[model samples]
Target: MPQINEKTWIIIAVVIALIGSLIYNIISAKKLKKKRQQFTRSIQSSYTHMKTIEDTNKKIYEISNEINELIREQKDTKGYIEKKKKEIEQIRQMIVTNDTILDCTISDKRDLATEKQIAFTYNIPTGLPEIQMEDVDKIRLFANLLDNAIEAAESVPAQDINGKNKRYIHISILNRGSNFFVTIENSKRTEISVTENQFHTTKLDAENHGRGVRIIRQIVAKYDGTVEFTDKGDTFEVAVML
Candidate 1:
């Protein structure tokens, strides 16, 4: 309990005030640091949520594309089924016929490619031996042949080839020794595909179509005949011997 000077008391008061201010500033700095950490955590959480949403959206997009592809496939299948029904009917009729070429005049090779601007020629002979199979088979054969010829000839626009336009078909039927020979010659094929003993047409008509050569082979084999397909650079020929 000593008596203190006023100046010393003032000095003590100033020191206490400075210490209090320092404590207050340190506490405030700790509080600010904690707040900043919380803000950083909040931002990270928001980013993670956005990433999840983005992944979900991507999955949904892929699912939508798959669904669209499935729908297109179903539509194509329906069209194919409808087309196959008509083709089946025609094949059935061709299978259950008993008519012969001698039973009637099979007139199918006249101006067959007229609409396609393709020149057609023929030397079909009369009084030939009747075909071993149904005459309907023969009709189908000729129709398919002429159609393929027109398709091939029309693919290459009528152009000058060495001096002449080569968009024409020449078909002949005659007797060779003891066998009936059917020969078909048409414009040269710039593009042709042959596999084994089968042939394909130029049209991209579905899978069920373009089987003309297969049908022709079936008919020829059924009648104990031999068929030949030759590609001669500028001309194509098919010969059937029965």
Candidate 2:
């Protein structure tokens, strides 16, 4: 081989340097593209994780609201149960004594009268005969009658508007060998409406107001008893014999 010239050697060296530089640039570009792809994957994974956390938080909030509602309902149910328990205790006492009317007067009627500012009086003998009836029937009979009398007494305006002669209610029960006589009298307002011997309610709620008399009549009829309604102008009286 002939000796290479100086210029040709210089040209060959420059071309070798150019080829190495080109190869290095290609390798660097490939590494940068791989890094970009990894960054994109990381961003996508973070977005998916954030969405999952939001969904879980939303479910937790809904569950908390439902738990609060259930707690409120439970409290209401407990209060209702307590009220019924007191009523049951009162009924038990009435049954044990076999004196439903007297018990009603002592318990509910007396308290109601006191609260409504009405004068309540009752004449029950010490040795009154035991009522010969079922506990339920006895309770229904006296409770309905007394309730109606008390309601009517509340409607009567104070005498002379000076509240001098306040409204009054009186109850009397007497034993007559085989049967009993029961009477309830109460102060009333004048201008009572009577349709076919039945008194109409003067209350604003006409639908629910007039059912008490019917119920009382039905209870009396069950024991072959008699009930009379007498509206004495300013005073009303209901008499029942059983």
Q: Estimate each model's TM-score.
A: 0.49, 0.56
Q: Against the true structure, candidate 1 has what lDDT?
A: 0.62
* lDDT by residue for model 2 (94-141), tens: 211245344533446666876888887777775786888755566557
Q: Highest lDDT: which candidate?
A: 2
Q: What is the per-residue lDDT of model 1 for residues 89-202, given as tens digits with 9 covering 90 to 100?
A: 533222111223322222233344656667766665545555554445565576676666666666766767575665888877777666778888888566654455455546
Model 1: how large is the Cα RMSD against the reference? 34.1
Residue-pair clashes, model 2: 0
Find the 10 residues in a row with the least total lDDT in model 1.
Answer: 95-104
TM-score of 1: 0.49
